[model samples]
Target: MVRIAHIADTHLGFRQYNLDEREHDLYNIIDEIAEKILEERVDIVIHSGDLFDSPRPPAQAYYAFKRFLAKISGRVKFFSVLGDHDTPKRRGMPPQKLFDDEIRVLGLTGGDHQVLRLNGRDVLVAGVSHFSRRYREILVEELKKLDVIAASHQVSVIALHQAVDRFFPFEEVFELRLDDLPRNFKYYAMGHLHARTRASFGKGELAYSGSTEIMRSDEISDWEKHGKGFYVVDLSGDKLDVREVNLEGVRPQLEVRIKYDAFDLELKKLVEFLKTYSGRKSPIAHIIVEGKEVDRQRVQQSLNKALLGKVLYFRSRIIEEPEKEFIELKPGDINISALLKEYLRDEKVAEFGYELFKVLKEGDVEEAKKIADEYFRRMMKIDSEKGVS
Candidate 1:
């Protein structure tokens, strides 16, 4: 049987939250992926796209990828397509080209196909790199051409980095539709989205191996559900067999939502979760705190004191519920003093505002000045008591 390891979206060099550990986490995943692919005894490894996180990757990222290539160079053949991130914004060749001839990246800009003899059976791999939404028409034309070419091959496979409307996360924006794809390939290899998916397409299975590491916070759900890894596609059998291989080396990441009311309880749970992974790997925690009124400064202080050294890093997204400004403006319900008191907890300021409003409306400037002086005096006294200037 012809074995093909379908992987994509390695995203090397991505230092999430600007943490050095995050950058290495991606590199570590590459190492683990290499080991897994070799263990599976695959004949070919096809990275659908995004071999590197950037078109011009960091020096360390290049070295990490080189180490992976060293492991699988002679043992297995490697092929890939360019993801949007791996393509340059201006004029420049991708960083993977540095390993020229070692890695086969297909279709830099257009459709390209190659045939390989595996187990005495001809396996055809053809695809185009990621195309922006603007060049989608050209992308369609290229796929049609590749489809015509696939008609001539016995066991044909098409790899694409574009997101199809069928499986794309967004309902409105899409690069290619399912119908836009050619109807003849034996398997459809897709990339870009970091989610594991499989469907019956064309004459065979359509699948996405998903990203090797957790690239974004939103990907946590899929990463947890499917686990991070690649797919092993066996092509020699009558019915195509696609098996998922999850890696054990992926760094753990957590998304915790701490409500204001349950701050202590949730923080305790989060601390315990981190403790479980002690000496194993520090997990990345993305905390979201929600409440109507919260002291952001105090929240940070409490977290710092409780979760110190417990996690690799903790990023909190504080969302404050907006307070009601006015009571939908009514004629007799205009009690400005009550509204001020509700928001301005300082009773002195609220009283001063009420008195000043009455004096100013009556053109009593001296009385308004007197109320302001008294308000400032009270504020100074309170600030002094709190040890503030």
Candidate 2:
């Protein structure tokens, strides 16, 4: 049976919370991932995309991946597609090109497909680099051509670094919808959406193997439940079977919510929980403080004292309910933009703020960047018209 390993969104060099430890954790995971892939004895390895967190990754990120490739270079075949983060904003070569001799990176220069003969059978490994939402037509055109090529192949797998609307709920940033994909490939190895997801599509299944480590606080719950990992696909059977291989040694992250009235009691419980994570690398904590009329200053001081040595670092968010006057409002049509404008007293600024809020709420970092750029451009144009130096 032909075995293929699928992994994506490693985001190497991402230093979450400005911690150097977090940056190196991504590199460490790559080593762990290689060790496991070797143990499984897979014939092929597929890194769907986002091999590095940025197009111009740090030098240490290059060295980390170099060591990883050194371990698996000749033993197995490795293929990767350039992710949105890995695609340069200007004319430049992709970072993966430096390791061209060690691996094949698809869709950057031209041909994104490679037909391989493994275990006396033909297997097609094809993928395209990321395409922004505005340039989706170009991506679709490429996929249409790939579909024709995939028609004759029985064991075919297609990878992409773009987010699909169906799997990725952010409409503003999702580049493609479910129907945008071709119905020919037997396995769809997708990336961009950090959450692991799988659905039966076309003749086989579409799956996102997810990121190797927790990149954000919100991803903590999913990571705890699914445990970060990769997948192994068996193509020699009547229908392909996928097996998930969860990685160990990932740094733990924790979250705790405390009500204002029971702060002391809840703090005690939280401290006990933090005490249990006695590892070389301490866990990161997200503390949520909730209640009406919450004293933000007191809570911050208390948390600092309690968490100083327990966690590597801790960040907190305070949630306060609207004023009692707001609670008495009649049930009627609610307009969030109108309310925001009322509070800001400037229609233009309110609109800009609302747009930013929407993108941040959806966790669409690309869209947030776009909105911020548009906001600044408009401001600069207005300033110029007003003769503001």
> What TM-score, computed on C-alpha atoms, does each candidate reach?
0.81, 0.86
lDDT of the structure predicted as candidate 2: 0.87
Q: Which stretches of candidate 2 lie over 4 Å from their true place?
A: 109-111, 323-389
Candidate 2, residues 1-389, lDDT tens digits: the string is 89999999999878887789899899999999999999999999999999998778899999999999999978899999998777875678889999998898988853379999999999999999887776888889999988989999999999898888886554445689889898999999998878788899988999999998988886898898898989999888879899989988689898888988899899989999877887656898999887889999999999999888989889998888554345443323455667789999999889888777765764557667977898899899999999996
lDDT of 1 by residue, 1-389 (tens): 88889999998988787789889988888899899989999998889888887777899999999999999989898888898778765568888788887988889879998999888899998989998776999999999999999998868888888888877645323589889999888888888878999999888888988998887787899988889999999888767999999988788888988888888888888787788898878788888887878889988998888878888788887877563353244443556768788889978678777667755753546557766887788888999999997
Q: What is the lDDT of residue 362 in candidate 2?
A: 45
Consecutive 10-residue window with the lowest summed lDDT within model 2: 323-332
